[model samples]
Target: MAGGMRNLDPVIAVDGCAVGGEFQGKARPEGKTWLEGKRWEAGALRFCANLSRCSGGRRLSSATNALAATSRNFRQATRLLGLDSKLEKSLLIPFREIKVECTIPKDDGTLASFVGFRVQHDNSRGPMKGGIRYHPEVDPDEVNALAQLMTWKTAVAAVPYGGAKGGIGCSPAPDMGTNSQTMAWILDEYSKFHGHSPAVVTGKPIDLGGSLGRDAATGRGVMYATEALLAEHGKSISGSTFVIQGFGNVGSWAAQLIHEKVAR
Candidate 1:
């Protein structure tokens, strides 16, 4: 991440922790990863997680941390767009950061505690939307990095929602971890604070009014888009070489649809 900050102006300063911040009065020297004095203290600090390992062994926090990548990309984008300094800081900062303890009783009557995190980047578009992932390695820093990504992702998609991402640093039983059941639990808990609001989420079980074929909708949409683009060029997907990355839900579905069209 050394040259990652090369493109951005010196106005984007760094705090003691090396995170991005605003320069109060003096512009910090070039290539300085840390700052001192009240003039360079933190006023706003946030970055999208890089999540990819850099060339060197050095790390901001985690080995595969994401802030560096996200931050560098954002700075380059702001430079390209010629956005204002104030607006750039505003976009980098998140709207909210939340941490909570989730305790549950085990089958043997013992108790277990797992940490959870949710970072809401923005909601000015409409509602804050992101994924609620459950994994044992989930942590606050990673969650914060992901939230920043969600903000711009929604904007690029021209969606009406903002970016937000959540994750629990633990796993669940196989049955409860599936799509419908997980959504049902969320709906029930949310209803306790607000009301019976099924609209709060999507991908609920069909019994709970989840969208029909919701699981494969994204992949299907991708396939349709590809077909349309190919059609415009006087070609089709049939017998064409297609490079589909990842085997997740979206990729799998998109591949399936394209495969049906005899695409290679």
Candidate 2:
């Protein structure tokens, strides 16, 4: 809501979230956003980089109050880096925030409508990159925070991409969410506006240009980050006890990767 997200309506499916710089009504064409007022948790960047590992109980902090302790830290980081005011403001703004309404027919011949959002943060380094989240209780603010987090993360990590977050508020899915099929649908839907923009999305089936090792990409990243962080603390991943939250692709791979390291 802080980023003129009110201006984005849930009427059209989405003419926003342009890939490769090709959308007509680009939000704030000047590449400025009003998201500095939004707050992010200290570890929110880490939380967002990985796929949805901690699912169902833990939220990404829906409250904007202090944005959960990273507000001042964010500014302090900028100050520490001796960033100029204009650049600082630019860093704080998101590129675009989009909301759309999507409806599909259920197997029972009933129509199901769901609300979807895509918040695209800065892309100075490269294309905006993020993940899709599906949950009945998906929080738009959380997604916004995630988008903001992605910008900070990719920038800091030099990942050569910006941040963007998308989610659809929908029901449980053994049939709907959490698989390559879902990405296929998303690719098709997004392609309706932008022709053959496969790169607009990731995690699709390999036949559809999906990359190898993507399933383990998030988990592998978590492993590497943990190793780096622990190295600074004079600790190692060996003999560590871990408690996983969600056993999704990310969580499962994280567990496996960490275990492999620990065993080694």
Candidate 1's clash total is 6
- Candidate 2, poorest ten consecutive residues by summed lDDT: 4-13
Residue 245 error for model 1, in Å?
A: 8.4
| Model 1 misplacement above 4 A | 1-64, 172-177, 206-209, 221-237, 240-248
| Candidate 2, 1-264: lDDT as tens digits | 111111111110011211111112223455332122232221221222222232211222435332233345578888898989888877666788889998899999999999988888778888888776677876666577677777887888887888887777876655432556667787898789879878877778899988788778767876776666655545567865455444566656877998898733
lDDT of 1 at 232: 55
**What local distance difference test score does each model get?**
0.61, 0.58
TM-score, each model? Answer: 0.65, 0.68
What lDDT is reached at residue 154 by model 1?
A: 79
lDDT of 1 by residue, 1-264 (tens): 000001111111123233231222334576223422333233222121221221111223446556666777899999999999899988888888889998899999999998888888888887887776676777776667677887887798898988788877776534222455667777788889999888777778888878788777756766766666556545677876665434555557777988899976
| Candidate 2 Cα outliers beyond 4 Å, as residue runs | 1-72, 173-177
Cα deviation of 114, candidate 2, in Å:
1.7
How far is 243's C-alpha from truth in model 1 (Å)?
A: 7.8
